[model samples]
Target chain A: MTPRSVLVAILAGRPNAGKTSLLMHLTGSPQRPINFAGTSVERVESRVVVEGTELQVVDLPGIGSLSALTRDEQEAIGFLQNRAAQGSERTVLCVVLDAVKLSVELRLLAQLSGLGLPLLVALTKNDVARASGRPVDATELERCLGVPVLEVNALTGAGVAALRQAILRRAETGRPMPLDIDPAAVAARVQPGSAAPARSLTDRIDAVLLHPLLGLPAVGLVLLAVFQLLFTGADPLIKLIEAGQAALAAWTVQQVPAGALQSLLVDGLIKGLGAILAFVPQIVLLMTLVTVLEASGYMARAAFVLDRALSSVGLSGRSFVSLVSSFACAVPGILSTRIIDNERDRLATIAVAPLMSCSARLPVYVLLIGAFFPPRYAALVLLLLYGLGIALAALVAGVLRRTLLRGGHSALLMELPEYQRPSRRVVVGQVWTALREFLVRAGTVIFAASLVVWLLSYYPRPAHIHAHYEARRAEVVAADPTAQKAALLELDRQEQAAYLEQSYLARAGKALQPVFAPAGFDWRITVGILAAFPARELIIPTLGILYSVGEVAADSYELGSLAQPGASGEGLRARLRSAVDAQGRPVFSTLTALALMVFFALCSQCMGTLATIGRETRSLRWPIFTFTYMTALAWVCAVLVFQIGSALGLGPART
Target chain B: MSHQETTLDCLPPGAVASVVRVEGEDQIARRLGDLGFWAGTLVEVVRRAPLGDPTQYGLRGYRLALRRVEARRVVVRPGQVP
Candidate 1:
């Protein structure tokens, strides 16, 4: 094919003009999620080769007549405003207009026309206009706006090539028939010399979404609904996975000989993988809610509602999106810090991100709450944990804002996106992406961690005892006489557990007890915490392994923890539960659970989050600092929680 | 020099100046529409919010937010704010 034109055309448009959607339609790449160099907010850039010309297309953040209401807006305006300063008279300013909403867009057309520069109007959503029976005569619209109007349907990618041809024609020719702009008409709306308009649509949206009287409650209810959906919707999926795990375990035990291989198959792979897999439901549900809210423009509305409060704590209200996601996973939540530009505010945000009580903590909380707190109060207790997390995060942010990272406050200046029903396809797309990412982590990182923990809990059997216990014991022991059989079984159980006592994870847990003894953590709790760092969901499986019940390992550890462990006997299980602590009370008390929750809430425990931070920041310093301080804070908080909780008669007294 | 950072809404309309300095928490100022204090670029105080938190201003044909305390930091020449 012959080259139609070799040219570089910069696609320009006002915001909400379907620039991004069109880019996606054309490029077929997810470049729409690229982060701005300094800002965490993503920018959409698409490259398309049309008839041999590779056009570098940028979806510039919308401009209001090259004027803005915020600093980021100014930066966007600068690129458009810089055409004359660059000593170039031919930067193609392709202003996009919605065919159906011509009146509102015409005002921008008039204002953009005054620049006395090259410009084109790509009339977008032509399909919607046509389907609504509004025939947009391109010539008449062009005459009315005094600019070239090209009809294009972003959904179908039709007329895009024609749009490119128009761009090429304009670029080759200096002035493509200047739009008929009367400065007087445009100047009437703007102040005589300033960009201040009499009123803005954003101001109207703010009146409703950010109203002091109604905004906060509205935001709370929205969040409550999101959490409720997560809890309610994830039930079926979680049950299905749990039932699958049980069936697999039963099948493995029946098929294999009653020996080491059967026990290992049932306990190691199936249990570990199943445990991590269970929480996928919560992650998927939470992400879907966030995607819908964000797409519907409520996320920005939330920023406005929380703007002043966040400013006082040295956080931008924009940080709310990241914090909301932190409720699902703090790892991606921290990586979202690219949105916050200031160093101090970023640090404060990072410190508090773990406080959002992410999904990894959900399974642990659900189990503990279901077991300990009454059903009527379970949700309230859950909310209380979330509330406590929010309060602690705010407190820490306040202190950091005032001290270590004093910052200039941020005022809310965000685009109030026009209200549209969030696309179901988009929400589903986002949820699928998040679920895939979560499973990928579970399969690789969590899978590996589970193996190490299981191994540590397995080997080093006392006095060279090996060759698979059930097999060897059957051959070597005398035929079952009641007294001898009981003695041998007890010896075998003790020897198997002793192997755990001697393993590295066990040794490390034992070594940390003195440090955790004040927090009411025995060696068992320390090992649980250790396993939980790679992922908080692992706490359940870690406990399972510590208790010799680690089924599905830490894989289903979070949401799947309540499943029956293999090789279970009611009497033996209760005996294990009643194991004595150094304080001569039963270990795993209510206070320990409370302390563990606090630690989970306060500590920056996810390795994936740390790795993401390192990737986003392109350095090790911030993530390292983040993980260290949050961990220290977690330890101190956990200790204080236990001490205070015990004194208040919250734990051990229940027995 | 200790730069002045004024809330954006408080700045009177029609004052022209250049952004000479910017100070406040980086993230906060950024959220409130505070770009860096580059050497060149016209800045103008445009409008104040009715609720008196974020004030809007025009700079280089764009409007952005500035809390009351941060607007004073621009340290601009008198001709740009308007």
Candidate 2:
């Protein structure tokens, strides 16, 4: 196939204008970042094939105007103006305007009309506008603006095909129509019969949502519902996936000949990928909830609700959205901070964003809590961990703002967009996009990390140990079938434990164990924590490997089974429970688990989040600062928790 | 003489005012201008946040919340005597 030449079609609009939805609908591609060839600036682009011509649909950050002050807005303008300077041929501007807020939207449109690029107006939210008794006449708008104004409802795919064709046509032969209008004068002309009401339905909704007495509690209830829906909706699917993965891993091990390939497929690839993909359901649900909240305009109201409290911590209400998103994962959370206009405020938000206990930390938390705490207290413990994350984030933000990024007090001068029912298509598309991202990362980074981990745990050439297990397995084969199977399992477990103890990873963990002693960590726990540096979720599988608990799926792995006595008359947990140092003191305790939880909650362990911080800030300094400070904070906090708990004799020796 | 000008932060809830001037020539002021808080634009303090530091203002056919510090930058004149 001949490579199609790419034409750049820039999609620009005000915040909440459905620009991203249009881009997704037009291209039918999940949102992917396109590094502009040879430029430092990168924007999300989808390769769109339109009428036998390939068009690169670049979705620029939403900006209010060309004179925008935020870095994101400036980048949007720079992308457009650079093309405009190069003579605007191969470039077309698709300006999406929210039909209900045409006056404000048109003001931005007016500024961009001077850019001298062929512009097509996508007047979105037609359904909402009509339902609210305010509809923009596309013909009238077209005639007034001297451009093809397409009335598009992104939700229903109305005018979407026509809009795509329009883009192609504009790219082919259209010229810049330099038409400008005084927004204030034209604002009154667009509304035909009824005057623009100062108190719209949004105000009434905000009355309740932003109310002093009910707003906070309403927000709390909404948050509870969001998480409840996420957990309940995703639990069954997670269980199903975990079971399938385990069964597949066992089947693959049995079917494949005993070789490195089988070990790689079963131990490294399957286990690693399964560990990562298992979180997809929860992540999808989270993206869906966030999309619904955002599209319905509740997110802005949430910012309004949180403005005062955030201000006390030197953050504006704008940081609320970013912080909330960080709970799911920090990459998108940092990306979402583009909405905050103030530079210092945005940086401060990004710096503390990873402390929000992202979903990557969820597996570790669940596994540890399930193992150490009772089932009845699971929900409360999880809530407390999440709450601790948020509290620490706020405290860190305050300190960072006061020291590193200090400046004028933050202002909450942001628009409260009119409430509209979230589009089902948009929410589905967002979830799909999030799931694709998760799978891609699992297929790449986690896959590689898992392979390395599997290799390290399988090495050091313990030939004698393998021979010994084989002899024992032959002897056990003479016994009954059940005894033979149990004997083989025990031999496998001993072989793995013996190999791991002599591996390079074990040596490194032992070397670092003393440093983590104050934090109540043993060599194995230190190894788990070290392995998690690439991604927080890796700690669970790492622990499974370190303890000879092979191929354990995080969601379904029974702690009781791991702790159950085997042929050696002791399980992994039993070994952990009885482990001691040179001084004959127990290595693991309840206090240690709590300290580890606190450490995971505070540490910047995920490489993706750190890389995202670097990309978003366009500097390595911030990411370095973020990693160093967060790690230091985690160490100190974990040490303090352990020391205090040990001093008070808070936890029993072994329950 | 200046029509008893007061900062937007001081305007009690439900009081309408027309912006007389934006205080600074900084980016914050320019952004406020971009958001339609320029001179002669009518604004009202619709409500205050729970802790009362940031106040929601109804202006230019939409509702926006501005902190007291940001609101202080906008000089306004009371629109009507109640």
Candidate 3:
């Protein structure tokens, strides 16, 4: 089959001009984000078949003018200039103009006209403009600007079909006409009868939402609701995913004979992939809420309210959205930093975003806090850990601004767009895109890392150890037939634990144990920490495997049982509690647990976050710098916690 | 009518003004002008942020938020409240 020739349509507009909504209407569903060549600036691209001709629509990043200031704006201008340089035969520039703000938006239209590309204006928000008593006539605008104009209401799908037809037609035969024009004059000409402006719905909404006394609290409530949804609302779904994964692994084990392939499938691939898949629910929920907030125009208002507070930490209000989102996951949070215009501010926000204590760290915290602290103090310690992350993030951002990323001012010049109902199509499309990106990462980098860790812990099974275990199993089976099953299972567990103790991973952990000695981590803890590099939540399962508690989900009630003082159960938490060192002393004291939690709170343990940082910045230096600084800080803080706690006599037997 | 010339940040909420000129050649000033703070353009001080630094201004039928540092760069002639 011959490939259909595709026509190109580039959507351009200033921020908050309803360009995105218009693009959503034109491209039905599913827009893919593609970075412009050689730069990190991403533009959403979609392919649509309009009247038998396939059309490729590219939504450029919003820009104020052709004379660009920020990197993203420069990239947009560069893309247009390059397209213009190439003889514009199959390309049409669709400029989205906000009808309510015709004069300001027309300025961009006039500037774009200078490019001499075939142009069409998509006039959006015409309904709102008309309700405000200053409606713009599309035909009059077409006559005034000497280009095709279509009145479009993106919310209700008004005039979308005509716009699509115009786009295709213009791409084929439209000619570039270089006509110098004044934007204000043209706007005035088009709107011949202007009435006094009535109080807008946006004004009434803002009067309450943006009020000085009530605005901050309202913003707080909104963020708190989002946080609550991410934190606990998705818990049941995450548990369901984990349960399904465990069931699949169990079913596989029962079907396949015990061998290397079975172990690899059940223990390595399925478990590793499931650990990430479990997060899909949280990611989808976060992306959906963020999209809603952004599309409803409430995000900008939130930023405006919080700008003063964030500016004290060398970040603008824009960074608040990214940082808050980091509390769910740092990968998406870092991606969201593109909203910030200042390069230095964006970079700084990206640098410290992971310190917001993402949901993945909750399992590790819960396990440790349950195993060590009393039930009464568990909540306090958890709160302290969260607070530690935020405090350190602020400190790091401030220090970075003063030193490495110095001299760039965080300019807070942003448009506070009028509130509008978020379009369902756009929200769903964005959520789907975020989910796909996350799953791709899980399938590639995380899958590979999981296998490597599995190999390291599975290899070099000496013949002597197997022989000894086999002999022990034979004696148990021979001595008592009735109790053989129970005895054999214990022997099998011990055999696996012994084999792991002698594996290459354990050897490396032992060799590096001295490095973590100040932080009170033994070889077993070291191995868990090392294996958790791929993803932070992997530490729970890694600890489970290392301690010979068998495979266990992170949120299993067995782990939670450790919090009860008089509870009786043989879980990973209990195993960790009773674990001993060479001197017959307990391996984990309360101080040690505190130090470990502190380390994990500050450490750069998640490879996904680092990889995202590299991709977002388009440089290896920033990620490397972030990894080094965070690790060093984590180590120092861990050492301090251990030393201080020990000096205060908070030892193993105290609790 | 004679009007008092002042920086944009000086106008109280609900005060109307006409932009005299944006006073700098830097990127911030250029961006301000691009957002429709040109000479003779009417602008109104809508409100200030809760912490009282960045203020919202209405111009060209849209609202914008600018910090005091950026707003202070735009010279304006203040008029009576609408």
The TM-scores, one per candidate, come to 0.70, 0.89, 0.95
Model 2 lDDT per residue over B26-60, tens place? 87887787777756677878888777767888766
How well does candidate 1 score on lDDT at residue A403? 80
Write the residue-wise lDDT of candidate 2 on A1-655 in tens digits.
8777678888899888888778878888777766774457767788878766898898888897777667788788888887788888888899998877677677788888899998889999866667767666778778777788888877667788888888888877757767778665565566442223355677778878888899889888998898778656876777777788888988997899976789789877887777666767677777788888988999888888888888778777888878877777776677778778678889989998999987778767766665566566766877888888888888988998888888854666778888888867668766666566555543366567667877876567568877887887877886665657766886787677777777777888889989898898889898888778767877766676666765454433332322332323233444455666557777667678789999999998877677678778989999999999999999999999999997898643632
Ranking by DockQ: 3, 2, 1
Instruction: Give the candidate number with the greatest DockQ.
Output: 3
Arranged by lDDT with the best first, the candidates are: 3, 2, 1
Write the residue-wise lDDT of candidate 3 on A1-655 in tens digits. 6577788899999877777677787888678877755444566898788767888889887889888766668778988987888868788999999888888888888889889889999998888888887889888888888788998887888899999999987887756887677776777777643211235899899999999999999998998899777866787788788889988998999999987788799868997888678778888898899989998999999999999988898888999888877887888888788778689989999999989988778878878877777888987998899999999999999999999999776798888888888989878977787777667644367777878888888888898999999999888878898978877887888888888888888888999999998888889999888888788777777777677787653543332444555454337767888888877778897888888888899998887788888888989999999999998999999999987877777755422
Report chain A TM-scores, every model: 0.73, 0.87, 0.94
The CA root-mean-square deviation of candidate 3, after full C-alpha superposition on the true structure, stands at: 2.5
Can you give the lDDT of residue A157 in candidate 1? 71
CA lDDT, every model vs. true structure: 0.62, 0.77, 0.83
lDDT, candidate 1, at A155: 53
Docking class of 2: medium
The numbered model that scores best in lDDT is 3
Q: For candidate 3, what is the total of clashing residue pairs?
A: 0
Q: How well is candidate 3 docked (DockQ)?
A: 0.60
